[model samples]
Target chain A: MNGSAYGKAEGMKATLIHGTHDIRVSSDVPDPVIRDDTDAIVRVLRSCICGSDLWPYNSADDNPQGDRIGHEFLGVIEEVGSGVRNRTAGQLVAPFVWADNTCDFCAQGLQTSCRHGGGWGSDGTDGGQGEAVRVPFADGTLVPMPGEPDDALLASMLTLSDVFSTGHHAAVSARVRRGDTVAVVGDGAVGLCAVLAAKRLGAERIILLGRHTDRTDLGREFGATDVVAERGDEAVEKVRELTGGDGVDAALECVGYVEAIRTAIEVTKDGRLVGRVGVSQYSDIPLGVGEFMRNVGVHGGVAPARAYIEELLPDVLEGRIQPGRVFDRTIGLDEVPDGYRAMNDREALKVLIKP
Target chain B: MNGSAYGKAEGMKATLIHGTHDIRVSSDVPDPVIRDDTDAIVRVLRSCICGSDLWPYNSADDNPQGDRIGHEFLGVIEEVGSGVRNRTAGQLVAPFVWADNTCDFCAQGLQTSCRHGGGWGSDGTDGGQGEAVRVPFADGTLVPMPGEPDDALLASMLTLSDVFSTGHHAAVSARVRRGDTVAVVGDGAVGLCAVLAAKRLGAERIILLGRHTDRTDLGREFGATDVVAERGDEAVEKVRELTGGDGVDAALECVGYVEAIRTAIEVTKDGRLVGRVGVSQYSDIPLGVGEFMRNVGVHGGVAPARAYIEELLPDVLEGRIQPGRVFDRTIGLDEVPDGYRAMNDREALKVLIKP
Candidate 1:
């Protein structure tokens, strides 16, 4: 593994997926190169495993040996191309996903839908799990850190790149108004982040649907006023019962399972909304017409994390929120496999990796 | 069937669904009577066959014998129980759906989602396609005519009962803002109404997706700026091409068919929304996460027509809109069977039945 040397070099180390349940960290991976004039090379300092990464891990694709992956990371700018603006070397920044902020979709705070946007871990883009990343549309994709990065703030700021902002997106899309009754379905990091977001949005009541005591404790600390640990139809009934039979005004679907999706819908009242940000483990979410016909609308899809980084960064920097708590375990670049195992085995709510 | 007699007598002619493809005008039908204190009997002036009626016509329900049907109607009050208020004999009015406005859902302007609400022709509620109809929640269900009804305006006013308001619900639920581009995906009467609604909402551009020249012609009159007469994938591609490869800003799915639903989703750009009010002929709309993960959102369901009656009644009364034109053919109550046949056979856009 090249003596596990952690420094900028001609070659870098990266986490690569060989196939389902097969992950590897290679020290001899190629270093990033700017492929676009607007691209910038970032030396990833901290990264994390995402719930969505499980998709590819579970997918049985033939010959899927190497596919660069990981969408969440905060890093220092090491190089910038001629067309890149608003960035310089040694600056710490967090990028949501790869996007050009000038697009109409980005202008409307939907950067994930940017016309020129693409996800991390693409064929050429540097995946966040790697030591270095080539970020396209550098000016739009990265938000400059408010100040020097600190060990205590790195995890929180890192979340700004994905989970934290994604949870905020769910709340915003659900139109979570002040004093609204909200139900968040899921106990993952995103779900806990949603609880925090709902609290930030001024939801008077927040009901979290999850089971693990450890996760629920964090959820409570994040402002979850109620917790219903039941699964399936019973979970739905418990939520409805908690809401005085009127159902919550808004619901956030953070788990992609059919039952979780169903419970989210069932716990929402007529003329309400269910904002879903979870990339489902299921290919299709079969929402029956009965759900829609009741005047309950489903809003929200994937989170446009890039659009929200700037909006939420101030709160994180000023010590208003501590989203880094989601990173229950921390490891170094050599331990990327361990990070994945911890998350996959449910031994950790989330894992942070640093190089 | 008894002799066809007109007026408030021992019996009145009513359209009854006997079985699939079997419709009858029975004069032996008993006159509507006040079953609840809040109920008021109305002497029907105009009514129409709805597209949804085809659901049962295509189904093989055993009770295929008889059930009073038809929801769209405007008429004059014939009598009211002692407890009834806001309605009196000879007063002209239109009811969206049979909803008790006092219900929590109605109070919130989602009358269609009222807990106690039911569609027309259920058990005791008066079927609009009759000489007289017993309306429950007289105060909430019926909207008083803005002025004395004129023969030239009855058809337009009748539309306020269902199709027009339902179409408006589509535009409203889709959150169509003024000066936005919108696509209406259907050629049915309700689709035409959606065109009018989009126009009323001040959309800068309106595209009608349909293959019918006759319907598209009326669509243009209703403010459609473009009409793409294509079906399936070709239709989606045509819309995307017209929209600069980004797809429409908002799409209204007005056809319940799977192809139409698929086309609507495909023609919507990332981060945009598709509002559907079509009563699905299919049991479920199979939407893949791949569609949603791209950032396209789907909203709208069965429109709450009862909630929009008062808000839209003014525009209709001022002659600013001519939704009545959607009714390409007019028939008497006794000719309801023919009206159904005409609609089913695609010989007319909509059929208006007057008593």
Candidate 2:
């Protein structure tokens, strides 16, 4: 594949955020060039719009003209820089949506805190919702599969680039253990993935707090043992009753709302733990000392996506996990705004874009 | 000391709580009898009124009339039941103020949560502020020193019966380490003792948040390296500045008020820990999830007083720790109501009551 591409000059197609709900599809941009010896150019096969991307898309403060978007992607290597030895052209690999796993924070499994880690389009890097993109730390961050995966598997594998890893981190931070009862406090893709992670981590029971029938069905398929349609106190009471009045052993809070976090605490028994994966924009929500003294532990910020991809890829390949089921809809690169609308309107659990 | 014969059958004087703020000093009650084989009756030599006693005294609900009121004491054993093997007649001992120390919870070093560890007065147990009292689980709960302690040492040792151990548990729960900076969130005896505990645990810097000059002086003497006269945000800012823009490594929350707990959280750095030792009468406070996700851990509840008595007795006997410095005044059993008034009015840090 490398020999055939020597004389070809290819331009990339990308989605740019011109303004809130005003994404523009452009194809006149130069293909990403590998600036460093450890970089590789990947021909994006599949990419997906993330929930966080919607923040800038709908925000008045975001660049009104346009900027690059998208983050999650799985692709085939198109070109490799001189120092890129582990991966060859035409091989399939997935890069962690946000980070290069070589910095100090990444080494500590805190890739979300990586010094160079930032959202793709927001920082001038071509967003993953494009035809081609450059991936740094290719040797460390990109996980190559055993062989080319089928289209279905490829779409699911794309989730490992972000959402799946995020959900897994939530479970890990909550210290979910075998035989522990867990409550997932969201029903988005990440929340659905959390159910998979909790099950893989051997949680005895998983109670998903969601209202969508499709999402809840996927949650059950991903090992959610129960679902709580009611929220707040009702949700907490139902969970406690399911666990013999002891509440859950762990709760994964994927929603950033104060009420959701509170529900997580109220739904867990004393000495249990709650892992919060939401990026909180509000700081005034106080953590009551009296409640925490009952032995509740709260941990988690951004997911260390780059750190978990390689560890989770093998399970994905072996069919031991199927996180991609969260992508309830898929569309072409030009349909980005509709994907956002679907998610915003609660019409889709996740939207995958095939470039 | 076991060779001494019983002098006479006589009635013992006790300060009883007839109702809210209605204390009666009487010498009509019979001497405490050892009902269990593992019990021992002790003649109180030194006892003190605690801040917690004020709760029942000031309760809007009718305070149980004719009940004993205090729970901190150091005394000599006057009699032992048949199955008592560790303590005998005439042995100087400090019994745990709350627990038997042998139940499942007690065995797990959570004696305060033991199945039978209810409040002494409410459970029909004689209050420590009396001429004599029966101690359950005498063999496991009371620690006998090598020899008789001097007056000052005995009073300080009496603190180990409750407050001192509680402060130590707060420090332990907060994971105070050598060279770490710590903050004590209250100015009461427990907070003062937390300052001492922080010092003992090798905290390099101790910040006491209080305004009382006497308590501040004693806090400094007890190893508080710094004192913050400011309250709320100002206090948090001062602590952060003292810590070079980072917050303290640990915070000991000794006040149950909403503001005090918030101050403790605000003054602790990301990834640091906070331990709450204050007793909360209500459960409506919100646990701010955003602040907690900065990697703060909160843990602590009722202290297992019995768990620390043995470990602290040696230091007390050697005159190395002076927890008794918290006692600002001493009064006779007849002056019980006055002692309560002094503490309730913040006129005394702690009041030692003599039988």
Candidate 3:
């Protein structure tokens, strides 16, 4: 099948932010072309909008580089450069990032730091919310699916490209030991996934901080033992009350706001940990002298999704876990602009785009 | 011997910082008297200066209430109150701050967060830079020395009160494993002791960042495998170059400044950690997107010295470690003002004061 078989023209339809609050789906966007032997052209199967996508969407600055925007995508390999190894044409792959696995950094499972790596939609590389995308360092970046995934597993597997792995990274970074109590601070898909991760990691209890009833319900399904609807200091007081004033043993700060970070730190007991997967928006998250005296440990940054894929593969493949349900809405490539709008308006928890 | 036998009159000599750059050896300070069962009046044997003490010495404001001024001391118990069960007169002990070890926080080994914990120089509690002091929470806070320490071991044992244990906290917090490569920032006594801690924890290699020949030599004696005598960016580049661009497995941020913290982060490999023991002086330590992308984990805060004393006691008792060597100068209690001056002037690595 050619690109036209998937509703593509001589060009690709991709999402681009024109300016503040402006998103457009245009077919004039050029199709990804392979420039390196280690690159692969993937025919995108599914993609989704991320919370971080909102930052640029709300920024006052207009898009200057006409950058290709989406990052979360899993696709079938349509073409592999001659130098590509460990992957072949027609295989399904979702890379952690566009990283070469051969670099010293990548060998230790930090693909995000790959020497030759470049993220989606940078330096002419197309984004994932398109008909097809070009992925660099394909051999090191792309992890092949264990088997041909059915639609039941497709969305969950696609999450391996970012969100699910990121949630898992929070759990791992917090050192979520078996039988420990965990509190997750955020209501988005990642925070909900963290609730699931804490359950999968054998946490004895999971407390989720969220106000939205719909997302909180999802939190319960994802193994949240309780949900604290209050926020900031009230939320912290509620968690402390629930934990019998000792605070939870571990906390996951999935919201980028400094207030969320502070609540996460406050709700954790002394000598406990707070894992932060959300991109920090503050230059300095105030670590209060009182909290510092408690000896709270803060760890986690970007998820090296490449490192976590293999660890989570069996769970997803064996039908023990289904992270796909995070997508409350799905739309075609032509409807991406609407998808972004629905997400921005909170009418949809997460939007999946099929291209 | 009575309290008066040790040259104690109705008043005893004490070091008081009246204001910035104003330290006095006053003989009018009242002698400590036990007022509670958990309280013990200790005739101080030895005390030492700390880097944290320098913070207010250069500040503009004078200390209100004239808080007794010091926190580190090793002393002989001259008297114990009725409620004290684990302590008695004549026992030599070093209490971590003035923490009541029976509190919920202290029971968990974080004396720094003890519910009833208070530092010296308060209402009636005196500073350690004196002939005698009243210590609260005799049972829980005081850790008795193994025996009457010889002069060769006294200063090292005195260090267990603060700096050595702080360095140990840095190493333990970093989770220093066998065969890992470690780097330590700052050449202060704490940094030198961190090199010792890393060695004691079985790190394969230790790197020290310092430009001081004398301190770097001490660092080498304390187990530094290599010394990168550069500052800021040059030091970071040098460590990376030496590590073959892979960066060290772990780093210790022993300097309180942002520049040192930045250097520690920059010299660490992706997914590695930097354990900080310095009293953070910056409101915000900027973590750039590059380091965040690499997944650099910064873990650590104040040293829970009370919690670590027992764990490190065996090493000190068996003569397996010589942490005392960090003290490069010794003086009588009357010379404490000079001791602080020498330390503030960078003329001494660390100062030990005998009462």
Candidate 4:
């Protein structure tokens, strides 16, 4: 099929943010094109609403004109620019970020901090929740799949673009190892994915801290050995009690809220670590003499999705792990507004966008 | 010889804090005794003042009656209570802290947070800078040396009780590995010791951020490959320049001041860590979006000195490393007041108190 088969004469359909709590799918946005020699245009197959997206959705002020908005997607390459090597047109690919992976930061497994990198929906770059995206640094940013995947595998692959990789980063940052006990703070898609990540890293016991039975039930399927429905100091006490008053060996903070971060820190054993992969909503970390006395430290920040994709891809391909279970609902690009509301209101765990 | 040979009939000379900038050696403090079955009386051989001590000295109000002080010391085991096993009388030993090292915290190498732990000079417990100290958790807290060490070796062993071990904690927490580049902030005794610790960990290049020529000269001798005598933003820029504009793989914050911690954080490479072994003087950590975006993290807190002594002792005993050189002056117990003044005034790098 020709690339234009997915595009309208003058534009393409895409998700745009107009104002607080206002999401819209506009069909007047220009279709993505390979503007740079190192770029590739990908026709998006799947996209999803992220918990982080709700941050701006809840508070950002009005813009008379809308701006493009999503970041996670898996797509098929429709066209490759002249200098794009290694990846070709017609390949199925996932772009972690528009990063030049050859930079020093990327060389150190920190693709998020790449000197020549940027995010989608900025500087006229097309967003993921659209008909197609213009991927920068094509050869360095896009991970091409070996073969076409089925629907289930495709959902799991889409998570490789962000959430699953972020959860894995939390596990890695917390230094979860064999025979360790871990506590994951949050029941969002990221937290559920972290349960699978901890299990993959050989954690002997995994605790899920969430009140929702529906989400907690899925967390159990992902390998959480225990669940605590309490909140605040009560949650701290309950987690400590469960760990025999010693606290878990590691804790993962998947919710960006201040209280969630504090609870994660509290439930971690002395001399251990707390991995905070949540996009922080607070500006300061409460680190005082008490935390210092226990030798507890917080480590994780932005996930280097590009660096982790290759390592996690094999398991997803062989059906050993399915992070896609996070997506409990699916809708077309036109339903992007409802998807955002469903996610923000906690009505849907995660809404998949089949554009 | 009897322990009484080192003590007076009614009391023993001990360093006490009276008011701001006021330190005194009183001959009226009661001699230490085996207060519990887990205790032992150690006849003081050597003790030293720490950087943290100055925090209170700079601001604390008057307490005319005076309170016992000092925390780091090495001595001969004078007497052990019946329950004290593994350690016997007459052995030369170092006490990192009065900790029951068998507790879960100690087992995890977080002796500072041990369930049955307490520092010296509180609740009638004898201070280190005295004729003798009532050592709690004798067998679990004391590390016995193989044989009698000379004056030089004795000073190094004294360092194992705190400063040297604390410095080692900074390097370890920062994940300093072979072939890595490291930056150490501060020019205090602990900072100088950190340079040695980084060298032992096989850091390829070591940068010391300090303005003091005399102290930095010792840092160079202790393995600092480069010295950046700049402060604040200038120091940050200089460190980045030294590391090829990429910053260092690890940065150690040995000074507890806010600016020192911030500098350490700024000079660390993206995705790397800053190990803060400094006794935190600030109440909060400035963790913002920029830090999160770069994936920079801060780890480390109080040093588990007891846990590190065994690993670092062999190197000290074999003469492969000399950490005692940080002590630029030596004094008798009665001169403890002058020792504090000298250190506070920057006239002394460190003062060793021989009782």
Candidate 5:
């Protein structure tokens, strides 16, 4: 040990939940102590609520006690463990919320379901919405920006923590090839981001199924060629007609509802692909095995945030991507419950919480 | 113009269905008149019943009033139109019952869903299980065998028309790469044939989910490395345990039911593929969007029989493949109803109706 580097106890502040929806601001929570040499502490700059957060918020039985919520964030490194050679204190970073990139599945791009790495906000770990968080496998999880980001870009950068990566994963898993027509089955932040991802990936045409004018405008700005205000079967027919009798080549399922999954399947052509990124609350979906046999490919899982953070960081820093725009509202940490309510009521696409 | 060969009024006998389940043995059906000049008329030497025939047989309201059922056969060519130079009269041939194989989709290996090809049995054309059949696109759809076949080999050769091709298609669509662990989710003839196909495709481990001892034994004989008797979640767990908790790399879904589709998803690991060959009666399935995001690929449709018939005929002729052994029972044409009943009751693996 280097004697010159005197020991100083690390400290962090986090939000804790006592029971279902009972979130409390706990400032004196001990800062995360580095367990592995490959860990680092990050001072969260901006964090936001995710759609998955609503699951526990809405379910009284599943989430017995108020649990830590939120999983997306942009942060700055406050301290580093001995083995973490890639990041140092004061460096701005964004880390994938789950997954270590070295796993076999992660290497194959199935990082969301990584076999060895995963962390939920309820696990007593620092949630992304908190002021400070601990990240393990720093080298494989965190990506540093070239420089400090301005306030305007921070929220968008924060979106990369999960939603952007998830949207990208959905598009990739759906096999959105060049010149392909794509349909996005949700209008949430992730769905909006998926529209952008699809455009960035060069889909020849993009169809967004959303009724909200603001979201629809964002979708169009992101390169959506058409918007279907109707939903379910009617939406499917509209997409089919837009493609001149053939269905879209790919579909991004961002809402984990049965109807949305069906819509994704219905709007896609034979031999096409559907990337589903929603956190499914229901276990059973009546997927037509025969219809899928007509050459449809379904793929998507948890977003491997770590695998994409690095690749997307530079783009965000260079202003090539604008994912943060999905955050229609930003508020102080205390207003989180209201943000949650607004999102639940579909009044906001995403809510950014600044602690 | 070839005037001398053009004006002959050649008549052929064919089995026609005038209404739902009303199959008639028509002797004076207009001989398949050559329309494109690339067609050939064959005197049927052998034809067998197919599992798909039961769809119309069992349906109470949806069955077409008049539609041919059989789509598997071997025959001797009696006449060839002007442009049909590939097969001469009296030549023994096996023809794909689908359509002309020159379509773009067919070239891309999706012949079953070909843009220009009509599906076998679904098309109201002459059926294969008859005294004589007219085959269009003779050069592309027909495969000439080595020499005259023995009786046993003829029955086996008849399988090349549909079952074997379908099995091969399922295996291929599942992306059964070399050294992969594979699971067959059905015990039908197609499933048994899939065992052979998986073996031929170099699967390192092949597990068959079945209950019948006879089918299990046949599966083992056809290259099933393991047999799982349990169904549903329990069976999925068994397969995962056998593959060291990772599940199989590829799965063949030959049973078209909700349970079978669920079983296929449950038994595959991340980054694996599932090929579904079963015609699903139910069009909607509850898909676990989150689970699917982990990277399971689903791809399969109707089997492109015409595409594989030619490629498989050589192997069949040389005795390198034994797909025909899947037929556990054989009956005369008049016994077709009993065959249907036995199959519907799950009492027979496959029933080959000889006409």
Candidate 6:
């Protein structure tokens, strides 16, 4: 294949998805290059498996030729295209989405819906879980680190790519104000991060609905005031009892499942907001006229990570927050298959990768 | 039936729903009296047919013994129970839901979800269309008028009971602000009032979606800058084209039908809000993850009319806004059946009743 001028040699190790539960590292994947004037080639220093990646890993149909996978990553820029002025080679940066942040949606802090935006690993773009990635709209999508970050700070900054920003999206969308009581549904990386986000927003109380002791323990340390292992109606009752039967001032739906959304709805008080950042498993939310009439508003979708990265970078740099703790395991590129399996089996909270 | 000693007489003319397409004024109905110390009896002066009332008028099953029907009304206080301290006899006032506004939900401005709240014409409560009515939690539910209003001003003040306040709720919930562009998805009474409300909230542009010329004209008078006579997809397209292909900042769903809500969703820009005050005919909102991911939030429900009356009363009284212009026809107690038919047939925007 004819390659662009900027990046290093062609062949590189990258993760690929062939079929359900089948992920593999391939050496034949082409290294990313400056394919556009606004692009930059990044030598991926760290990447991680996202909870949503498991959806396709479990259900995507078989294809003998695999497709690139993974979206979250931080890296050192290897090259910059002619039009990119904000970034240069060898600079450390975190990338969120492929977005031209000048669009109206981006201007409104919804870069995920940018007019010239798309996800990684599509339309010949390199996946994050690879040796290198071709990042489009470099000036708009990448946030440069102030100085070289230590390994711990690097890992925490990597979360700004998706999870932490997503959690922040939940809290912001729910309009979590100072002294408000919030309920966060789920205890995954995003949910735990949401607890931290709620705390950061000055929430007086955070109730995390999760079953795992290990996850909830971390959640408590992350600022969850109460943990309810119960789910469904029982969870609703437990939250109500905790809130003196008034329900939380706001709720965050971090689990994509319908049951989790229902729980968030049930635990939210009348006239309050329920922020939903989960990649939905169900098409239609179950909110009905009864809920609407009671003024239980449901908002939020995909996190505009690019928009949030700037506001959160300082806190991450200064060690004001420890978002990296959500990543409990690390692996080489070859171990990505095991990483997928471990996450699927609920054995790992998150799995970080070093290519 | 037993009657208390507050009203002029027991038997009174009141509207009843006999079945679908069957509404009648029945003199056999008993006049209301204060059964509780917090109750007050009101002598009915003005009432109006609501868009929601047509739901029962069109679909309610045939019952030889009819039930109480209408809900929107304003009147003079004929008597006040001992415990009522805020209101007194001979006061002209408007009533929303029968809510004890001191409850948590009411305190939070969601009077419709008040813990001890209920609608009119249920559980031995008198319908507002009757000659005289019982108002529970009188201080919490009724807003006293500044002075006796003229016929024109009285018509406008009557709207403060439901339609005007409901319209205000839609605008408020959508968070319409100064210089914002808004779309009102319906040209009914509530829709027209929403246009007025949006204007009052400093919306620079209001696009009204409706097909009726007479109603849309009133909408224009109420401050709609543009009008689209299309429905469904065409309506969405027309509205988008009007707003330079970037949808409205906020949308108000005034029609209960699912199509109107869908239109509201489609015509709203990404990362914008759609406030819905319509009594939804469908159980599930059509907002999927795609819409959610774009940050299109859907908020609003049954308007907390009781809470809004106080905020809207001054403007209605001082002639800064004329929300009462939504009424296109007037009828007497005996002509209530005809009024219902005219409203159902779309021959009247709204019909004011003098009982």
Give the least accurate 10-residue stretch of model 1 chain B, judged by summed lDDT: B1-10
Question: Which of the numbered candidates is closest to the native, going by highest TM-score?
Answer: 6
lDDT of 2: 0.79
Model 4 C-alpha lDDT per residue in residues B1-355, reported as the tens digit of each score? 2334434468788998988998889987888767677888889999999988888788778999887888889999988887888999999999877789998788888888889888887667877888889888999999999788998999999999999999999999999999999999999999999999999999989999999999999999999999999999999999998888889999999998788988998898888889999899887677666777778888899899999999999999999999999999999999999999999999999999999
Please identify model 4 stretches exceeding 4 Å from their true place: A1-9, B1-10, B61-65
Among all windows of 10 consecutive residues in model 6 chain A, the one with the lowest summed lDDT is A1-10
**CAPRI level of candidate 3:** acceptable
Per-residue lDDT of candidate 5, residues B119-169 (tens digit): 444544568766666677677677777677887788778887788888888
Docking band of candidate 1: medium
DockQ of each: 0.54, 0.23, 0.47, 0.74, 0.50, 0.73
TM-score versus the correct structure, for each prediction: 0.94, 0.78, 0.89, 0.93, 0.87, 0.95
lDDT (10s digit) by residue, model 4, range A269-324:
98888999999988767766788888888888989999999999999999899999
Question: What does candidate 4 score in Cα RMSD to the true structure?
Answer: 3.1
- Tens-place lDDT per residue, model 6, B210-322, is 98999999999999999999888899999999988889999999998788888998888888888999888887777776787678888899999888888888898899999
Check candidate 4 and list the clashing pairs: none
Can you list the residue pairs that collide in candidate 3? Answer: A101-A140, B67-B121, B68-B121, B156-B324
Roughly what TM-score does model 4 have, to 2 decimal places?
Answer: 0.93
Tell me the lDDT of model 6 at B211: 86
Q: Which lDDT value does model 6 have at B269?
A: 83
Model 4 chain B is weakest, by summed lDDT over 10 consecutive residues, at B1-10
Weakest lDDT window of 10 consecutive positions for candidate 2 chain B: B1-10
Worst 10 residues of 5 chain A by lDDT: A1-10
Q: Which 10 residues in a row give candidate 2 chain A its minimum summed lDDT?
A: A1-10
The global C-alpha lDDT for each of the candidates, from Candidate 1 onward, is: 0.83, 0.79, 0.83, 0.90, 0.76, 0.90
| Residue lDDT tens for model 5, A1-355 | 2312423355445655554565566556665656567777788888888888876667645433345556787788887889877789888887765556778877976666677666646344567767777777777677786665788788778877789888998898788988889999888888999998998888999999988888889889878889999998889888988988778888999888888887888788876678888877556554565465566767776777777777777777788888888888888777777787888888888888888
Give a tens-digit lDDT track for model 3, residues A279-314: 887766555445556778677878888988989988
